[model samples]
Target: MAHAFDGKVAAITGAASGIGLATTEALIAAGARVVLVDRDSKALDAVCARLGANAIPLVIDLLDPASCNTLLDGILSKAGQLDIFHANAGTYIGGDLSETTPETIDRMLNLNVNAVMKNVYTVMPHMIERGTGDIIVTSSVAGHSAIPWEPVYSASKWAMTCFVQTMRRQLNKKGIRVGSVSPGPVISALLADWPEENLRKAKESGSLIEPKEVADGIMFMLSRPRNVTIRDMVILPSNFDI
Candidate 1:
């Protein structure tokens, strides 16, 4: 009669808002103690308050590798084990090929690529030591199918997708389940700042997807038995032909 996630510890990045926050909520509902990670203290505090003491907040600027190590150490020290590692934090900036700044592109890669690697390195040791765990990386549809002007974002996601897939092959033998969730066009903070008319047009054109829908897909993947490893999953709106 034990819940699937009972007694397990989940470490999630970007737990302050958007898809990351939603994923944290989903895991908690399934009975896992969570380490809520984000750069924003106030937002993290608000999320932790709502989730109760079972949730611990660790503020980390994903751009800094040392900070990542410290946060991971704290989680493993406090929780003793890391049952689930969710690399679910990312950023985006949209502009034409000529309009994008070098700074914007660099920022996107730093957040989406380097920080993801930090999470992997942080939790991998514990998983390897225990010989069992689940690792889920939040990739994007852009990983598989590139957009017209989203070069850095596409490259970063593709890197994540590839890393997780390769990891599945390498880590499976170690009794670790590694997978990735590639969500397409989710209507979340990912693009909340865009002009309403532009956003509406994309939705009206049938390209927009939902955060909860994606979160549900993640929960489904995580709910599977230990022997079941979903190498990669791509969730696109019905409108996406491919």
Candidate 2:
């Protein structure tokens, strides 16, 4: 009856909803104690209550450098050690580049790029010192290609995709596994603001995936034996065209 993640501790950002929340549930089901990190206190509370005692809700904004410090400190203080870190917190801004405001650009880059870098930076030492850990970043299909519709978003994900790839090699000798899951489109808040026509088309064509499906991909990567590292996985809806 033993599970692959039994006795392990995981901290996931953006855990209040979407892929993050689904991953938390999957981890907990696999016997891992999870710390749900998100910026929404009320949503975090509701999710934790629904998830029961195994889920610990921690509301910390990933955009703030100090919050990253607080998150790591709080995780250690509460869970003692972190065996997995899912740097899945991110924001998306979709549209023509010319129409995007400078402030919006800054916000997207800060949350999608800077925040991810800071979280990994804050957690790497701990994982390295312990000589054991897994880091899975939620990237996007956009990262692997130049998406004209989401130029800035694609740039952010491209940065993460490269970062994860480089870190995997850099940390391999240190015993930490680094990887990324690039999903095409999922039924989550990330798509809530998508252009109506595009959203409708995706829905009608059944080209959107579920959060749990992406969670399953994450678990597959994490469940691999220590000697086996699934470096990168691009998961997309079977019927997705782009």
Candidate 3:
């Protein structure tokens, strides 16, 4: 099938690893110019090298607006226009509700939730001016519902999910599309702290999903016909209950 991403521009967050990295590869393969933003400088450099000239690496601390501005400027300098913004960066933290510290809440919210909302608010104006653009935000299955140990993560994802839903209608008249994707347990070192036995059990159970699966889903949506849009898609492993 013809790839719809040819000559497009994409901005991705938390892009140095996992789903973000996978999505970068997918976009590049589809012939898109991608701006990869993340705090991980080493990994970001490696990804850019692997992707050659099609990708740009920006070491950004999403908590800092200055960093984001540098990213926007870099993209404009390189691509001249922003076509798709993939807000796919985040971290995972696990703790019980009562055990969750304020620091943890703030950190996760700042990186996972705050970065997403800020990116949308910052990027959409640019899209609005263009008259045709798309935003793909990554939420977790955890965000759609809740897990016993992940209260704040759930709240943050839910907030992002709701914001996208609300913005879709507002942005529809401008011919911009807003879509959200939620993935179930994805493999990452982010899961390292979990007890070894339980992690092994979960892996044995085949509940975790691969980064490529989520990335392909993103590419599929981007390649859809101009008038087609998916409000949101939840991707849990077939064996998983979510």
Candidate 4:
């Protein structure tokens, strides 16, 4: 019962928790050696220990633009080569635009949009040289449709959606596949920014999906045949609404 990703090398950002953590676990279970990238060293170490040898913990603060290059370099230096990459590191900023401070806005955009673009750019040459790889970015339903509550977060995701689409066309011809996983509300730390009332309502209504569900979609995208690319997967709990 061999899996498609068996023995593949994958590097996932924000790999200590939430969607990223879930995806790391899934990849490990599928027999891929995963590099866990996160700023939380303690949590990263804990995860590495929990998952055993297949999980390689790499502590990094991706907010620094230079770290994007460092991340790829470190992975190559340690793991030898990278077969898959998931730009799953991001933050959430809900509430009205006016309520967000300049610093908050900058942080959200840097992590959600800028870092993702830079990460993909930094990894492209390597994947291109190898002429085969898979890149998946974690987007959100808000990316597909503007959500009034979190304007900044929504804008960042929309930008990611565009980036993934354009990068796919740019890289596909070189044997690299690019795609995105856009999920609705999920149980994760990102929801901490949401209004408590809204969060409670979603939970009560069973509208919030679990992080593992989103990870499952990512697994599906990665498992697709080399000749086929799952361009974008918008996974939402059946009862969840925009």
Candidate 5:
């Protein structure tokens, strides 16, 4: 059967593992050509080899702002046009605000916040020129509410949530859609890094969602009609309290 995204081109950041990797698989299955962007060249190459020809792995450090433009150029150079840009690359800083060093804080902000903005900026003009594009970000439920244990991570997601909402309003008339998938407690590298106790509790309770589930939500958002934009979809496990 034919899929809705047949022949579409997508670029996803942090595609080496977790939600990003799951989303890459989902897009490729839907018949879209995907550019899998991640800093881990070895893992990325292995994944691309597994995913086959539909997947193109581009290893670049998103923390370097210039890499954003480089990523855009690479996508255009390879695919000629980009239809979807999933700015789903993010890091989690788990702990009290005081426990985080300035360097750690900077790195988290750069990857989770600054890099997102730069990627959108690099791709927006191209999408605007074409008068069609979709930008889906992977935010967190913590962005919609306070998470005392993850103050820095929450702040970074909140920034992303706001950016997605604002950009939707700014670009809707240009035929571009901006939205986010805010998931709670997915079984990804980020969640695996949580304090051992919390990870164990969530796992024991089956309170963590899978990366593939979040990717499904992203595919639904992308498959929507051009006039229909899912501004935000908050996905959570049924047993999740927050």
Candidate 6:
């Protein structure tokens, strides 16, 4: 039986854990060779080993402009052909913006917005040359709504929302599909700052989802027929509100 991703090559950033790792496992299960890109060498190596030969790990800090620019090129050289690119690497900064320092603001914006934009720009021509590819960026529910608690984080996602939608139109005729997976709070390290009581309450109230749920949403987006594009899929837990 042939799989949708058979013979395809995918490179996912922040692939060492959480949503990235879940998606990588999903893709590999579907027969795609995956390049796991992250800055943590130890975690990357562990995941690569656990996932076996199909999981290729590449360690690079997306925060650096030079590293971000060469991400796709490095993948192509290793994987030989790039068919899928998931820009899942990002950081979070919630709570009062007043307490957020300039450095913190810069880091969040750089990882969440700058790195994603640059990598997509870098990979476009290659995907264009092939005339086929899928570009999915991991966004947040905050991207579509004005979440006051995480104003700065929300702002970054809003930028991603605009970027993904506009890129979809721009690449429509070029045979490349651009989309975003916007997921509500999932159980991940990103929630480290959340108070333990709040986390417990959210989980008990069915307001939190697992990382695999988001990965499933991504799989749905990628598995759709090429002619059909799922521009944005907002995945949230059943009881999630506001």
* Residue 174 C-alpha lDDT in model 1: 92
User: Candidate 6 — what's its lDDT?
Assistant: 0.93
The backbone clash count of each candidate, in order, is 0, 0, 0, 0, 0, 0
The whole-model lDDT of each prediction reads 0.83, 0.92, 0.83, 0.91, 0.92, 0.93
The residue-by-residue lDDT of candidate 6 on 116-229, one tens digit each, is 999899889999999999999999999999998899899999999999999999998999999999999999999997878888999899999999999999999999999999
Q: Model 6 Cα RMSD, Å?
A: 1.1
How high is each candidate's TM-score?
A: 0.93, 0.97, 0.94, 0.98, 0.98, 0.98
lDDT of 5 by residue, 116-180 (tens): 98999999999999999999999999999999989999999999989999999999999999999
Q: Which pairs clash inside model 6?
A: none
Task: Encode model 4's per-residue lDDT on 115-169: one tens digit a residue.
Answer: 9888888888899999999999999999999898889999999999999999999
> What TM value does model 4 have?
0.98
Q: Give the total clashing residue pairs for model 3.
A: 0
In model 6, which runs have C-alpha deviations exceeding 4 angstroms? none
What are the per-residue Cα lDDT tens digits for candidate 3 across 172-201?
A: 889798999999888875677566886787
Worst 10 residues of 3 by lDDT: 68-77
TM-score of 6: 0.98
Which stretches of model 2 miss by more than 4 angstroms?
none
Model 3 residue 189 lDDT score: 57
- The residue pairs found clashing in candidate 4 are none
The TM-score measured for candidate 3 stands at 0.94
Q: What shift in Å separates residue 236 of candidate 2 from its native position after superposition?
A: 0.5
Best-performing candidate as measured by lDDT = 6
